[model samples]
Target: MVEFTYVVSSIIFGSLFGMMAIGLTLTYITTKVPNFAYGSFVTVGLYTSYSLYRFEAITPYLSAPIAFGIGGLTSILMYLGILRPLARRGSPLVSLMIATLAIDIAFVGIFGTYANYLRYTYVFIDSLNFTEILGDFSIFGSQGLILAAPLTLALITIGLYLLLTRTKFGVAMRASVENPSLARVLGIDVEKVYVFAWFLAGGLAAMSGSYYTLYSQGGIATGSGLIVEIFAASVLGGLSSLYGAAIGGVIIGAGENLLTGGGISVFGNGVLDYQKGIPLVLMILTLLVFPQGLASLPWIRVVTRIRRISGRLLGGIRRLSARGLRRC
Candidate 1:
């Protein structure tokens, strides 16, 4: 029973984390910048929702967009108004990284200074029934968010994949990621692509944050250390692949929950609170084993990429072959 509860809890939380991580993965994939401020974006999102909630004029679902938009707009403003301009002036990568960190600090200060700020409480929905993976296992209300958020994430993932592969804008974004200089030569608006990436990242992150508030009645900076957790999941998912990051978030959530549930005498048999270290440990282990990530494994992700690329290359060759055959 104990094991069943732990595993169930892990899966629910893990999936939710994955949803929260999608934008982080996207931003990192395109920008090649680990944007430590990503968590702050989440903070922006939650506060955005909370702000609307205060007015008694909005519902949770509606407030979600309000939060998401605030985070997204802030990101757009930063990229268009600040970061892009600085980088255009020939700023180094290290400088850019530091600038992002500084922005986060300033953002947090602003959040703290607010008179009636968003505070996502850790405890909410004390009990709720959910689709259990096993027998008769129940979950907390927050656990429901764990499930719902990931479903939203899956939709977002499909949407993003379409944007990256099917849409012209997505291709341009991918081209920018591959080589911004070359992409610019090919007539891609590299600046716009980057700005779009920032907005998307911030907007999605905010959705996650607001969703977090729904799970926990948040009014404080519950997102302070979120970057580290996101980073660890990103490492697990595959630093270079968005899909990998999402997967990593799920695994991190599950593993941490399972490990801490055992009360294995770590931190003097502390209850699940020590689960916080699971992501860190999984991160170190993952880096040591599959530095490219689980998504890079032959059985799942890497092989598929190889096949897709191969199919495209061979299709062109086959077309030429048929043309020559007809001419001959």
Candidate 2:
């Protein structure tokens, strides 16, 4: 049987990764720019949950809603206060990307200050490892996270699917993303859609971060540390497809955990230090092999090619058998 810890770890990480990737993809689709500071929104959620836990003795899970709200507000501020204004001035895509990078750099200092404040006020370490503080119940000799994490991800996925496919707002959001000018002509509030998209993106990222704090150590630099993995997942899944992003995040997350765990078992604990490189390598491979990403692959053509090859091999083998029988 697979180790229970590995299973739980994979599920938690995959679910959180998927959530973050979806958020990143959402903003990218809406604004056509990758938000480098998106990771900071995650840190906002982490701190929000941590603060609530420390001050009110509330659980991180319970504080997720607060984290979502704060994260959404922060994202809105970034879009309205910086990105929108720059966009109005007709900033180039590179400039907009650099702007996000600047926001990320600013967040490092901002979060660092917050961490220092927490240390001075609470008289406790700002770095968090919730392994001891958060209690878990056993299910089939495994931790509850195995169930909770994946279930949460599933529900969120379903909710998003319904919202995007069934709701009028979702239709408007899609129209806005497809063509803001046309959406405006159709009397849709394109700007409103963009604002909501950013808000939703940040909210999802923060919620994921709240969940992340339960299993991993979180600190001021946690968001910075995770940004690369988030980008990898988004790129691997195809930035244009939210569902693809979700799938990519889960694959990367699970692959990273399982491969790292296997490496550690064979190569000792030193291998753990290289865990981050797994996602980076995967991202590089994806870009080189499938620039358009997994979602854009022609699956029908691929399956047909596979069947053709199999048929050819089978025919060759039968011909060889008939020749052997005739010789006998």
Candidate 3:
């Protein structure tokens, strides 16, 4: 039963992580920057839900749309007020990256201030846990999050697929990302596409964070603390591929949870202390071995090799069978 719980937890965590990674990848695709402030956008959503819960008794699930709107607005502000202006001024990529880092630091201060205000205005714990408030149900003896998280991820994936493949704006966004100068020459509003990209990224991040509050203990620094894992998942997936980011996030999340649990069971509780290191290790190993990431692998070539080998083996077996028949 404990193991079953662990499995459920891992799946839920993986789904959430995948959602975050997809957002991160979207920002990277549009801006060509790591967007160190990405996690802060997540916190923006977390606190949005937190505030609603504290002030209005609203559930996080119900507050997701509000969180998405606020988070998207915040992201747009960052891009327009900061990144866009700097980019227009011909700032270097490193400068843009540093700007995002600075924004992240600034957000920490902002979130800290907000948290302090909430503490003073209302009596509540520093760490927000909505497990009881969320009222998660059991489906086939498993926790509701086990179903909800993955279902949310699937819906997001399908929505994104339809948007990118079916919509005119999506085509323009893709073209802009692929070649901004060409897109501009073709009369596409590259800047508009970028703004929308950042908005979507922020919205997705916040929505995931809102959901996260249902299962995890969240605080002002919760999103900041998760930044490393989010980056690890993105890098492991191949920063260029959104689909890869999703797969990478799931792998990282599941690997971290299951391996940490196994280590604790085998080596005792002391192993729990190193749980955070799992994602870092995964990131480092991925960089060393598959620098282009799992998405860039030669999967088609691998499949062809396997098919050729199987064909040869089958031919050899048929020849041996014919020899045996002749002898008979």
**TM-score of every candidate:** 0.76, 0.91, 0.90
**Leading candidate by TM-score:** 2
- lDDT, candidates in the order shown: 0.71, 0.86, 0.87
Tens digits of per-residue lDDT, candidate 3, 143-216, equal 67788889988898888888888999989988998999999999999999999988888998899888887787
- Model 2 alpha-carbon drift over 4 Å, by segment: 1-4, 127-133, 307-328
Candidates ranked by TM-score, best first?
2, 3, 1
| Candidate 1 residue 89 C-alpha distance from true site, Å | 3.0
What tens-digit string does per-residue lDDT give for candidate 1 at 1-328? 2465676667655765676567777777766666877788887866666555554635445677777788889878877776778877988989889988988888777777552222333222211111111111124633455456667778877888898899999889989988989999999999788778888888887887776665544433555577777778888888777777778888787777777766654444556555677787787888899888777777867679889999999999999999999999
Worst 10 residues of 1 by lDDT: 127-136
Candidate 1: which stretches are off by over 4 Å?
A: 1-12, 116-146, 217-219, 262-271, 300-328
Lowest lDDT 10-residue stretch of candidate 2 = 126-135
Candidates 1 and 3 compared: the better one by TM-score is 3
